[model samples]
Every structure is written in C-alpha cells, then in structure tokens.
Target: SGDLRIEMRDLAVFGEESERAARAVFAAGKQDEYWDYHNALFEGGEHRPKSQLDDDSLVSLGEDLGLDPMQFKQDMNSTEAHEQFDTVASEGQSIGVSSTPAFIIGGKPLLGAQPTQQFTDAVDEALARAES
Candidate 1:
C-alpha cells in the first residue's frame, strides 16, 4: 500500500551463522540487489535448511542473483558490512527485540509471527493514526 512503507531489519539472534548471513545481505544492498538476494535465500522456505546458508552459499546466491562474485565476496567480508549489521542488530535490541520475524508498526512492537489479519489490523490502525 502507498500509505505504508515496510523496512526490514536483520537481527542475528539466531547465532554467528545468522549474523554472517545478515552481513551478506547488508552488503548486497550496496549493489542494489538486497531483495533479490533475500528472496533467493528464503525462496523455498523450510525446504531451504539453515545448514545451506554458509559463507560459500551466500556468495553463490550473490552470483546467482547476477552480483559480481569477487565484489560481493569482498563486500560481504568487509568491515562496513559487519558494522552495518551490528548497527541494525543494536537498534532491534534497544527496542527489546531478540528474535527474527519481528514487526514494528507506528512504534508498536508486534513480536513473533502473526496472522495476516493481525498485520492488516495493525496497518489499518497505524494508517488511521497517521491520517489523524
């Protein structure tokens, strides 16, 4: 909806592997391929096991997404990418978030997975508040 804008923040509460993956995503954003990489990583959902998201897998995903392999790899391992991931993770922590799939609408925390209706209701409420 034009009235709503969604911003995704990565919180690596899952562990080091998740942190690395998050860093890779942030790095991908620099090349204007964040969504492509993100979608590719989670395309099959549960069918795509966590074990397959290692450093090598991340680079391969970048390559598959048409990103430059060498540049993508360098960016993924860069200090800037690590810093960006840490910054976002810290922002989530400051808001009492400690897990993935968390949503915040109009500064209200909607922790964990929710039904479609819950998101719709939150969006409606937020839009109403914004309009007022």
Candidate 2:
C-alpha cells in the first residue's frame, strides 16, 4: 500500500449552474456516493454541449445512480447543503484556490493544467518534507 491520500474539495467557479452542481454533489456525498456522482458530472461535463447542472438534471443523475429521486432533490435543495457548499468554497478561496483543477501539495499550490512530472515532483517533495 501507499501513503498517498487524495481528497476532493468543492470550488464552484465554472458557470451559473456550478453552485447547483456543488449542492447536488454534496447531497450525493451524504448518501455515500460522492465519488461516483462527482466522476459522472466531470465525465458528462466534458461531452455535454448544454449544461446539465440544473435541478432536474441533477435529480435525474441521482436516479440513474439508484439514489432516491425525491430524497436527493430534498437534500440538494436543503439549506444545510447550500451552507456546506459555501463553506468549502470560502475555505478554498481563503487558501488561494480560484480555479478548477487546482492542486495543493505539501501546502504549496500547483495551479492549472500541469504535466505529470510536475505532479510527481510535487508529491516527492511532499513526501520528503513529511519524512524529514
């Protein structure tokens, strides 16, 4: 096994519907299908011409994932889910994350599309710091 751990955070900056997507994904997380929903959104984002981040589309996505349709909508529209999205977005902004696909390795940020070797170097440096 490896010591590497990966965590995803919400930073809604893509479009008008991004905040809606964030809340929907948060709701999915509550049902323990966070990564599945997250991955589906990302994959869909790449191919879909029109934005699928609306409430109806979000609920449909949950239904496809076997989540309760009504419950998913309820959770997605709940005040708590919105607050959670706001909190994470605020936290990311406080830490200087302002864009999609940003990475923070060892407390140092790597912003925007980067090469694989760059990530390798960053991880190696992070591991070195941890070991030292």
Candidate 3:
C-alpha cells in the first residue's frame, strides 16, 4: 500500500526530489489526505508547483483534506518514503524505461507524453496483435 509507482529511470534527480513528494503522499495514504493533495496539485487542471507544491502548500492541502499535520510532515521526508520511490525508478530502469509516462505494449517501447488518441491507437494495435 505504501508503494511508489514510477515509470522512469535516471531518477538521480527524481529519487532525490519529486519522488520524495509522491512517497510522502503514498506513505500517508492511510490518513486519506492523498486525494486532497492530489486535487490540490492536479484537480485545478494544472500543476502549479511554484505555488501549490511546496511545504506550505502541502501542509495546507493536508489540513484541508483532514490529515494530521505532524504525520504528514514526517512522511513527507521519511527515508522510507524516498526509498519506496527509488525502488520504482530502479525497477523501471531495469525494464527499459527512460522517461515518464512511458508504456510498454506488446513488448514495444512507446515513448512520450502524448494525447489520449495516441494511447488509444497503441492499445488498439496491441490488442490486435494479441488477438492474432
């Protein structure tokens, strides 16, 4: 349940930064404040990390979402939290992932953060291959 889901490698940067934030949320998942933090960063239809993804913002999101402030902070910087994300990155690298949002369909490498139609087309092709 406290697992980090990553689809990229070269996490030297990710492991030390972005993943820390995500791990904090995942480890604190039991507090049920995940969605609130998630919504705060994403529901607005834009990720304004400059204003919404900082310590103050994270604290605000946790409180607004009804999570314990102390616990949220602890998990936010916990070594375990960072480690969880590191594992995800390592796994991704081992599996040939070099970027974010990469998908492996029918053993094919599909890179890039594209539109829904692009993904749909890939899925359709993968399904067709499986059927054949």
Instruction: Tell me each candidate's TM-score.
Output: 0.86, 0.88, 0.65
lDDT of each: 0.84, 0.86, 0.63
TM-score of 2: 0.88
Scored by Cα lDDT, where does model 3 land? 0.63
How many collisions per candidate?
A: 0, 0, 0
Model 1: how far is 68 from its true place, Å? Answer: 1.1
Worst 10 residues of 2 by lDDT: 44-53
Range of the 10 consecutive residues with the lowest summed lDDT in candidate 1: 44-53
3-43: candidate 3 lDDT, tens digit per residue: 22333232333333365456656645747656566556456
RMSD of candidate 2 to the truth, in angstroms, is 1.9
Question: lDDT tens string, model 2, 16-78?
Answer: 588888888899988999889888877855733345778899899989998888889999999
Prediction 1 global C-alpha lDDT: 0.84
TM-score of 1: 0.86
Regions of model 1 farther than 4 Å from truth = 47-50
- Which candidate has the top score in TM-score? 2
